[model samples]
Target: MNLRKEILVTGAAGFVGRETVKQLLAEGWKVRALVRTADTNPLAFHAGLSVQEVGDIAAVADWSSLVSGCDVVVHLAARAHKTGEGPNAARELFRRVNVDATVELAKAAAAARVKRLVFVSSAGVMGDFSARPFTEADPPQPASEYAISKWQAEQALREICRQSNMELVVLRPVLVYGPGNPGNLERLMRLVASGLPLPLASVDNRRSLLNVRHLATIIGRALELAEANGKTVLLADGNDLSTPELVRTFAKGMGIKARLFPIPPLLLLAAARLLGRSHDAERLLGSLQVDVTLKTNLFGALPREETLRGLIETGQAGR
Candidate 1:
C-alpha cells in the first residue's frame, strides 16, 4: 500500500532522519529524502529512495518543487542548540529555521495539496522535567530557546493546517538514544564509557527515553494512521529509569561496571545551579515522564529490553 505513496523527508541525513527514511523504505514506502550538501547520504542506494540535496533549509526559496508529488512531508530539519551560543542569538536562529522555515514548508505542502505533514517536535517543550507524566492537553512551558521555537512552530503549523486541506501530526518525543545521538544522552554514555565515578546514585529521577528506531516506527504510524491526523502526541519508550539505573544501563550496554557513589540530590542541584547548569542537572536528578492518564495513548508501550538494546546498539555504533 505504501509503495505508491512517496513521503518527502527533510533532514534525511540526520540521526533520526536517516533512521526514519530507512524505516519507511523498509515498510515498503517510497521516500524522497532531502539531504544537506555537507551531509552524506544517510543510506546506501535503494530503489525506493530518492535523495534530494537542499543546501540550507532556511534558505530554500521555493518548497513547491519539493512537495509537488509527495503524499506526506516528514519535517525534521531544524537548527539545534550550539555550544557557547547566547540565548538571544539561539532564539533568533531557531525561530528562523524551526518556526519560520517550518511554517513555510507547511504552507507549501498545503498548496501542493499534500495529504499530511508529520512534524517531529521535542518533548522538552513541556520543560526539562515533569513532576508526573505529560499529556497532549498539558499547557506547554518551553524552558529553553530551542524548545520555545519548537512550541511556536507547532502553533504556527496548527493554525496553518487548520485553515488548509492538508492534515497535521505533531510528535513530541523525549530523549532519543541511538547511533549518532548528539546531545546530553551521548555525553552521558561517553561519561559512563570513561568510567568516571558519577555521584548520582542518590538521584532518583525518573526519565523516559525513546529509541531513534522506535521514533522512526512511530513516524510511520503517524503517517498512515487516520486517528493521528490533527493530533500532537507525546512519545517515549515507556521505560522510565532513575539516574543510577540509567548510568548502570549505559555501563551494562558498554560492558563495564557502573562506578557510582551516593550524593545528596539537593547538593547536586544546588551545585549545578551555581554553575548555571541547573537544567542539565535537573534532567539527571529529576523526574520527567509521560503517560496515558488523560487517555491519549496513541501508541503502545515498549519494554525495558528495547531501551537496553537501543543503548547497546548505540555503544556498537561508536556514537
Candidate 2:
C-alpha cells in the first residue's frame, strides 16, 4: 500500500540534474536516473538509487525501458550551444538531438502512462531583443540554433501532450549559477577573484540569474502541482542586477574588493569588438531579465538575502 511516487530523470549526471536527483532522493521519492553512460553517473555512491545507462540520447530510438512505471519524467538532456558547425549542419544536429529525441521520449512517456513530463528549456528561447523582462506571454523569438531547437521541442511537446493523456510542463530558466557552475558566470567569478580592475562599472544592463538549488526545488514543485501542467514558466531569482552590481556582489561573496571603474558602455562595446570579444561584451553590457512572478506563485518568492548568500557560497566553493 506504499504510494510513494517514482520519478525518472534524464541527463541525471549533469550539474542541475545531479542537484535535482539529490533533492528528490532526500525527499523520499524513488528515483530512476537515465544517464548517457556509466562513467557519467553522478549518483554512483547513493544506495537504492536506480540508474540506467543509455548511450547517446540523440541515438536512442526507444525510451520505454527507462520510462515505464515512472510517475514523472524530467527531461533535461539536450545538445547545448555547440559551435564550429555550418548553418545546415548545426540545424540538423540540433533537430536530431534536442527536437527529435525529445519528441520521441515524450511519446514514449505518454505511452507508458506517465502522469507528467517536465521539460527543462532555456531563456535564450526568448531571443536577445527583450525590451523588458520576458514573461510567458511574450512571443518566442529564438535566435541561436540551440534556442530554436528548444522552442521547436516545446511546441512539439505541447501538441503531443495535448493529444495524449499525459501532462507537459516547460520551464525556461535564466542563466543558472551555483557551485561548480561553468561558462560566463564562472569566468566572471575567476576574474573577480584574480583582483583585476574591471571596466564594467558603467555598464548599466540588468540580468536575471537562477541558482541551481532553487531550480531543482522548482522542478520538484512542478511535478507535484497539478496546476503547473500545460504551462511554460519563466524562471529567475526575482532579483535583477547590473553587471557592475553582480561583480560587486560576487566580490563581496569572495571577500575581495571590487576595483571597478566607470567606462562608457559604447566604448566598452567598441573595445570588445576590436578585441574580438563582442559576444562577451554583449553579455556583460546587454540586458537579459526574466519575469519570475509565475515561478513565485508556484514555489514562493526567493528572498534576496537568501539569494545573495547562495551566490556567496557558490563563489566560496569555486575557490
- Model 1 misplaced regions, further than 4 Å: 84-89, 292-297
Residues 250-285 of candidate 2 have per-residue lDDT tens digits of 888787788999889999999989988877778889
lDDT of 2 at 279: 73
Can you write out model 1's per-residue Cα lDDT over 1-319, one digit (the tens) per residue?
6578899999999889999998899998899989887356647799999888988899999999999999999999988877655444656788889999998899999999999999999998988778788877889998888999999999999999999888999899888888778877877888888988899988877888888988898898889788888888888887778879878877876778999999899999899999998767776888888763321356666777888888777875642
For every model shown, what is its TM-score relative to the native structure? 0.94, 0.94
Candidate 2 global lDDT: 0.86
* Pairs of colliding residues, candidate 2: none
Top candidate, metric lDDT: 2
